[model samples]
Target: MNASMLSYILLSCVLLSVQAHNCQVREIIRNTKSLLNKTEESWSCRETAATPCSCLPIPEPGHELACFVEGTNHMMEHNMTTDNRLFLLNQSFQIQLDRNLCESLTSGKECKYKTKGTVKTFLEKILKTYQEIHKSRV
Candidate 1:
C-alpha cells in the first residue's frame, strides 16, 4: 500500500471518531434537557403553599445552552453515556431524599408532609455541579 493511501485511511478514521464524539455529546444534551423538563413538571405538580417542591430555577434565556455545555463536559470527563449519567443522577437524587418521605410515598400512606428544603438542597447540588462544569469549560 502507498504511504498516501495509508495517510488517507488514518485521516478518515480520525474524522469518523470526531463525528461519533459529536453525536454522543448531542445525544447527552438532548437527554439531559428532557430529564430536566420532566423534573420541572413533576416539581410543579407537587408544589403548594404548604409543601412546596421545586427544581433548580433556569435563568431567563440561554440557560438550556449552558446546561447542555455543562452536561456534555461532565459526561466527557466521566466517560459516561447520556443514559448512564441520567440514571446516576436519578439514583443520587433518590438517595438524597428524606427516607421518611420516600417510605410514606412508596408505602401508600397519606404523605401530606414533605421537606421542601431537602428537595431544594438536592436540586441545588445538581445545579451547582453543572454550573461548575460550565465554568470550568469557560
Candidate 2:
C-alpha cells in the first residue's frame, strides 16, 4: 500500500479504537445507573446516616479503577449504608472513570466541591473529577 493509504488506515484504526472504548464506558455507565435505580427507593434511609466524605478518597490520575475498588472495599469493610454505595457509584459516573476525585467533569471546573457533606448538595461535588491528564503528576 502507498504511504498515504497506510496513514489513513492507521488513523481509521485509532478512531475505531477510541469509539470502542467510549462505547464500553457508556455501557458501564448504563449498567451502574440501572443497578442504582433498581434500589433507589431505599436510598433515603441509607443517607440518613451517610458515611463521612472524608472517608472517600479522591482517586488520582490513572487510578480510577484502583480508587473505585478501594472505595468500595472501604465501604464494605465498614458495612456502609446502601446510600453511600450508590452515591459513590453515581459520583463516579460524572467523571465516567478517568478523572481526579474532587474534579468536576462537565464544567471543566477545578476542585469544585472538596467540602460540604450532604447527599443533595452534591452535584456541586459529585465524584465530578474527570481529568484529561496533560502530563504526568510525578
Candidate 3:
C-alpha cells in the first residue's frame, strides 16, 4: 500500500481501539446497575427477620456506573410495575440500616441477620471505592 493508505489504516485502527474502550466502560456501568438491582431484590425477599441474612454479591467499583443504573432500574420496576406497597417500604428499609434491623427483628425469627450485616459492610466498602474513583475522575 502507498504511504498515505498505510497512514489512514493506522489512524482508523487507533480510532476503533478508543471507541472499543469507551464501549467497555459503558458496559461496566450497565453491569454495576444490574448488580444493584439484584441486591435490592434479595433484600426484598425475606420470610422473616432473623440471623445470617442472605448474602448478595456486591459489584466492584470498576462496575459502579452499571451497578448504579441497575439499581435504578430495579427501583422503577418495584415502583412502577407493582402495586405492592411492601416493595416501597422494603426499598426504604434497605436505605435505613438501624431501622431495617429493628423492623427485621420485629417481623421474623432469628435467621440471616449476620449475613445482612456483612452485606451492609460490603456495600459501604463499594461505595467508598466508587467515591474515590469519582474524585480521581474529577
Candidate 4:
C-alpha cells in the first residue's frame, strides 16, 4: 500500500479506538442510571421507616458509582429494617461485581462479552449504598 494509504488506515484505527472508549464510558453511565433509578424506586416503596428516601447520584468523571441518601431521620433509628437489610445484602454483592467491571474498562481493557453486566452492577452499588446508609441512619 502507498504510504498515504497506510497513514490513513492508521489514523482511522486510532479514531475508532478513541470512539470506542468514549462509547464504553457513555454506556456505563447510562446503565448506572437505569440501575440506580430502579433500585431507588424499589427501596423507596419497600422501606416504610424511611420517608422521602432517594439515591442521590454523586457526580464523578469516568466509570465510578457513588450515592447518598436523603430525607431520612437518622436520630430515630440505628439499624436497617429486615427488608432493607436483605435488599442491601444482595445489592452489595452485585455492586462488587460492577466495580470489578468498571475497573477493567478504566484500566484499558475491552468488555467484548457483556458491558451491560458491569453497568447493572454499579447501579446496584449506588442503590445498595443508599439503602445501607438509610438503614444505619448514619
Stretches of model 1 off by over 4 angstroms after superposition: 1-32, 40-85, 88-121
The C-alpha TM-scores of every prediction are: 0.25, 0.32, 0.26, 0.23
TM-score of 3: 0.26
Which residue ranges in model 2 land beyond 4 Å of their true spot?
1-23, 31-54, 81-138
Error of 4 at 76 (Å): 39
lDDT of 4 by residue, 12-129 (tens): 8886566443333433334335544544223332223555322223323332222211111120132223334334333432343344423422332221221222223434544444
- Name the TM-score of candidate 1: 0.25
What is the per-residue lDDT of model 1 for residues 1-138, given as tens digits with 9 covering 90 to 100? 999999999998886566333323333344455555544323332445775333223322223333323333433354333445566554322332322222211232122222222223334434554454444545
Tell me how candidate 4 scores on lDDT: 0.36
Q: Write the per-residue lDDT of candidate 3 for residues 1-138, one digit (tens) a residue.
A: 899999999998886565333323333333434444445434432334563233333444233333333333454453422423324333332332223322211232212222322333444533454344444545
What tens-digit string does per-residue lDDT give for candidate 2 at 1-138? Answer: 999999999998886566334423433444344443543232221322555332444444444444454445544455444545455564444344344333222223222223233222221122232122211211
Winner by lDDT between candidate 4 and candidate 1: 1
For all predictions, the C-alpha RMSD in Å is 15.6, 10.5, 15.2, 15.7
Model 3 clash tally, residue pairs? 20
Best by lDDT: 2
Which of 3 and 4 is ahead in TM-score? 3
Q: Ten-residue segment with the worst summed lDDT in candidate 2?
A: 129-138
Of candidate 3, the 10-residue stretch with the lowest lDDT total is 104-113
Query: What lDDT does each candidate get?
Result: 0.39, 0.40, 0.38, 0.36
